[model samples]
Target: MGIQHVGEIAVWASARDGNADAFAELFDLHRDRVFRHALRLVRSQHDAEDITAAAFLELWRRRDAVRVVEDSVIAWLLVTTNNVARNVSRSRSRHQALIDRLPRGMYQGEGAFDAVDAHIDAEHRETTMRGALAQLSIADQNVITLCVVEELGAAEAAAALGIPIGTVKSRLSRAKARLARLAGDARAAVSTTGGAL
Candidate 1:
């Protein structure tokens, strides 16, 4: 193993031994990467920060079960970030559904302001993209997040995913094609309605 990898593994080992300084060192090493992955998926700074925190907290909580693909803890941290993002998305969907069921007039006021067309369009596109992503199988989503979004190498992604490299390659290709098609269809549907639900 490379010196850097060896050092990282050592740091994790220290953290596992209840060394606060070592744990802090590990967090400092990985905080930005974990946060960036979360931001890419969630597109919100605040939510992404929460996801990052949760992932690290889970890393500490489940230190014994941590997987070290390529002799690094990054893969595990990234996967945990994905899981946390999924949970956040699910909770948001549930809240939105509940709000949709409520009387719309209840939240409207006499001075309620309408969003600009650009803002409306942006929200429409984001919703469309989210819908498209939601349609993918969890496996497809995970592969895409690692190989496509995070730009991890195919072998590394395979290791993290616990799948063969060829499987990661093929799944990534298929997932990208499917996502593009689904996003296009979603966009078309939204445009036909003039960005309104």
Candidate 2:
């Protein structure tokens, strides 16, 4: 076996035996990819780091169950990253709703909105795309994250999501439609505000 395979086998054995060092080694090897996956889903560096750490914590806690599979640790990381990212999204959505419901002038500051505005323009259109994606259903969000953001094929996304490939295609189609509507709305809002100014 090559170095990676040998390392994976060793880590698997040590993890099965509940060795922290082995788990740490596994974490070190997978952390960057895991963080990137989390970043792609969560869309915030801080949240992504937190999610990645939480995922690794769960993996460490469930070390015995984390064996060397065909995709090795990367697949496990993706699964964990997805779950944690959804949790983070839910929390943020709830918090934002509460903030939105607050009386105007109760909370003061355009700082956050200003920051978002700064990221606008064609060069940062990906940020706009991500914002539009946030308006999608949770299921659609998962499908888009796996298939589009993560660049997994429909069949692979279906396997990851425990659904049929057809289902993945259907969800992605709806997600794209919803994303387009949301993007249009965002653009309209920006245009109206600019006209007012």
Candidate 3:
């Protein structure tokens, strides 16, 4: 093993032994990577930040169960990020449904209306990407996030996901095709609607 691997093992061991400073060091070392992975999975900066925080919180909560792979806790963080993103997405969907059920006139103030419009416009692309990802199976989404978005090799992704390399390859292929089709359909919809809504 390299020097960095040895260092990581030491850090992980310290953190596992309830060393708060060591755990914070681990967080500082990996926060950006975890945040970026969360961003890709969730597609909203704010939500990604939330997911990143939640992932770390989960890491602390599950410290006893933490499984380090290849001398790093990143694999565990990525998996936790995925799970947190799913929960956040589900909660957002439920909240939106509740909002939609509210009487329209209840939200009809001019400031509220303008704010809603601006928020929707700002989130259009994120919404589109999220929709595209939603079209994929959870397994496919996980593969795409690990292999494509995070640029992990097939072997590494398989290790992270506990799947066979062949399965990662096949799932990535299908996920890519599905994302392409979804993008095409989104573009067609935009053109059909003359870029409105």
Where does model 2 exceed 4 Å of error? 1-3, 7-17, 41-44, 62-69, 93-124, 195-197
CA lDDT of 58 in candidate 3?
93
Please state the error at residue 19 of candidate 3 in Å. Answer: 1.4
**Which candidate do you rate higher for TM-score, 1 or 3?**
3
- TM-score for every candidate vs. truth? 0.81, 0.68, 0.84
For candidate 1, give the lDDT of residue 25: 82
Q: Which pairs clash inside model 2?
A: none
Q: Write the per-residue lDDT of candidate 1 for residues 40-92, one digit (tens) a residue.
A: 66756899999999999999999988888776788889889888988998898
lDDT of 2 at 140: 84
Tens digit per residue, CA lDDT, model 3, 32-137: 9999888876656888999999999999889888877677788778878878888898898898798789987765575886676567656566666767886777
Clashes of each: 0, 0, 0
lDDT values, one for every candidate = 0.82, 0.73, 0.80
Candidate 1 segments whose C-alpha is farther than 4 A from its true place? 1-6, 105-131
Error of 3 at 32 (Å): 1.5
The order of the candidates by TM-score, greatest first, is 3, 1, 2
Whole-model alpha-carbon lDDT for candidate 3: 0.80
- The lDDT of model 2 is 0.73
Put down candidate 2 lDDT per residue, 66-134, tens digits, no spaces.
534344566556776777777888898899899989988788675887665465443335655666765
